[model samples]
Target: MVLIKDVGSEKDKKLSVSEYIKLLNNSLSNLYGEVIGEISEITISAKGHVYFVLKDKITGYVLPCTIWETNYLLNGIDMEIGMEILIKGRPEFYGPFGKLSFITKNVELVGDGALKKAYEKLKEKLEKEGLFDNSRKKTLPLFPKKIAVITSNYGAVIHDFTNNLRKSGFQIKILDCRVEGSESGPELALSVRALRGEDIDLLVIIRGGGSIQSLAGFNNEALVREIANFPTPVIIGVGHHEDVTLASLVADASESTPSLTAELIGRSWEKAEQSVDNIQRKIFSHYEYSLERSSKILRLTFEKAKKSFDKILKIHDNTKQSLRHGMQKIKEKIKETQNGVSDKKIYITQQFQKSIDEVNNKCLFNIPKFILKKYTKIIKDKQDSLKTLKKLIETNNPERQLELGY
Candidate 1:
């Protein structure tokens, strides 16, 4: 609370322009010490002085405000048009302009309602500027080895985040900062600056759930801007489901809880693991199918070869038996015709013996040789095909390809 001065005693005094301005300044040294209203207009000069009009909601009254550059920065409020604010200062009469203005010594945002109004205003402005577009958001890396976390180190949010992270190889760097109230603005700004030049893959900010008032810092314009232009992608887990902060809107990713944020960061590694498992299962299935098919083909070939050999053997036996029966019949004929023509009988026997010899050589040697040659060629072809299939499997093997830097 600010103290009020006695400006009533010198109100009726009449004097020259400069004299009157001086008198008014002395009398109102501490008067109009504090004012609460919505800003109707704001003007910033080249020299960094801020001029604005504060209007009362109920009375529709307006007061001009002058905040010097130094005071503006010290206040830590990102002032804008139509934002309801509380300003602490005294009244002043500018003699040259013949006007009255309030010299603001300190300025701060009002309550949650006022902050919400400002949030909506800033949100609209940023949305129109395309600051919240998905096209502008950066993609989080698949396996981030170095992570920079910004939050309250003493909070349960940090513990939950570390516990939920499944990857043991992550190198997490924590920068503890305020997560509530106006202090968050400067603290977060510094944290972002500190991490800007870091060798980090991602930036994370997390905090436990809190009231809208305590979480209002997440809605700060400074923090939002820092996140928008951050060097690395940002992940925000302030844990407010009902309301989304402007910082989250500008970040690369946003989650409702610290554990959820951790899961998101580790999603790439999880997907990779699943992919490897699927590939392994597929390779095993293919290998078993190849082996089964090869064995069946080999068995069928062996049976066909055996059947062919047996058929050739049967043909050889029948030919031999026919030759013997013919010889016996010739012998009977020669004996009966022994008294008729001995020469004719001898010639007939010789012709029959020559025919039998030709048949024996063809059936016993050439036929078996042809059968074995045909089956051997068939078996060789099948073996070559199986070797080709084996090579194809090895070529397509995932593990083998990985080793070769696929």
Candidate 2:
């Protein structure tokens, strides 16, 4: 005989195995779980419980399941031995058989192509949102202050981008992510958000060389949306010569390989440097012109000794000082033309350098002004020749000269 020490509190009561399973199903249904899985079998039992097995591709997980519905799946739909289905189902465990089950209610047929389906759906959504519009495209900055790279850590993609960028003298911030498999979307989105606070002028979303399936995470809708809304411009470097994904379409620029993207950016920087070289030359030449012009004006004042000579010299001095100050302003303006710009400034002054040469030639103090006097005489001789020709044509025609001389 057993003596009962009655612990009568309801809190002491333990749940039965069946009750625990029922509670688990309730919790799972509350969570609203769904998966895209491949079905291995479908058959009708005499008891009318439909049994099947669902397995994942990469993981190869097989779950034996039963659906308790009279007509949930249509009869004569002919589900074969190997068919993939998107199962909207709740987990169940039968106490009698001691077997696990997924009692699916709403099943959609998508064949055995998870990647293809995901690609099509993502492409459709992105296209409809106008993420791929040409109007939204931004020209890349030639000399970006900093660039953000998002890719898997310690991979060929990240390695190539960082090394090349450092060699090219660009600052880089890398946002590491899982570039493949199931957790890819969340990781890609995290990388995109990381760029928001990094103060990057541009972003590079990159992946190593791999199959189309390996890069599927970059094609995820959430990541693509984050990219489309990213404040900084993005460059997609997926590294495939063929088979561009939807992410490429939505990005600001796309390159086939990581190395190619780096090369393109480096070329743009070179062009900006070339422009700076050109502007520097022009600015120095401009300053030289100003100095020459000022010296010429100063020397001109020393020449004439006549009435109001000092007064006129004072006027010329003031004018020369004012023009010198004006030249300084122009020189400063020309120096600022090196900043990166879409279109080159088209208003260059013609003969600007030649004018400086003329000023420099005219300002000589040690050399005699004999060359100037000689050039003046030559101009007078040309004028006299023109007058002689006109007067001779007016009176002494060749025929009239023949009669007079004869």
The candidate scoring highest on TM-score is 1
Q: TM-score for model 2?
A: 0.47
Which segments of candidate 2 are over 4 A away from where they belong?
1-121, 138-142, 166-170, 181-183, 266-268, 284-406
lDDT per residue as tens, model 2, 1-406: 2222337753444567777677666776764557777777777778766788888877989877666544232211223456676666677677688776777654444532655665666577668878899898777886786888787786577667656653556777777777774346556776687678777788888876565556655656667777788888889888542457667888899888888777766777777777999999999999899889988776665554443687788999999999999868755553443221112211212253355356457754444589656655765685577467546643544444545764
Error of 1 at 328 (Å): 13
lDDT of 1 by residue, 154-175 (tens): 8688999999998659998999
Model 1 — which ten-residue stretch has the worst lDDT? Answer: 336-345
After superposition on all CA atoms, what RMSD does each candidate show versus the true structure? 26.4, 33.7
Model 1 score (lDDT): 0.80
Candidate 2: residue 120 Cα off by (Å): 4.1
- Runs with alpha carbons beyond 4 Å of true place in candidate 1: 1-76, 80-108, 308-406
Each candidate's TM vs. the true structure? 0.56, 0.47
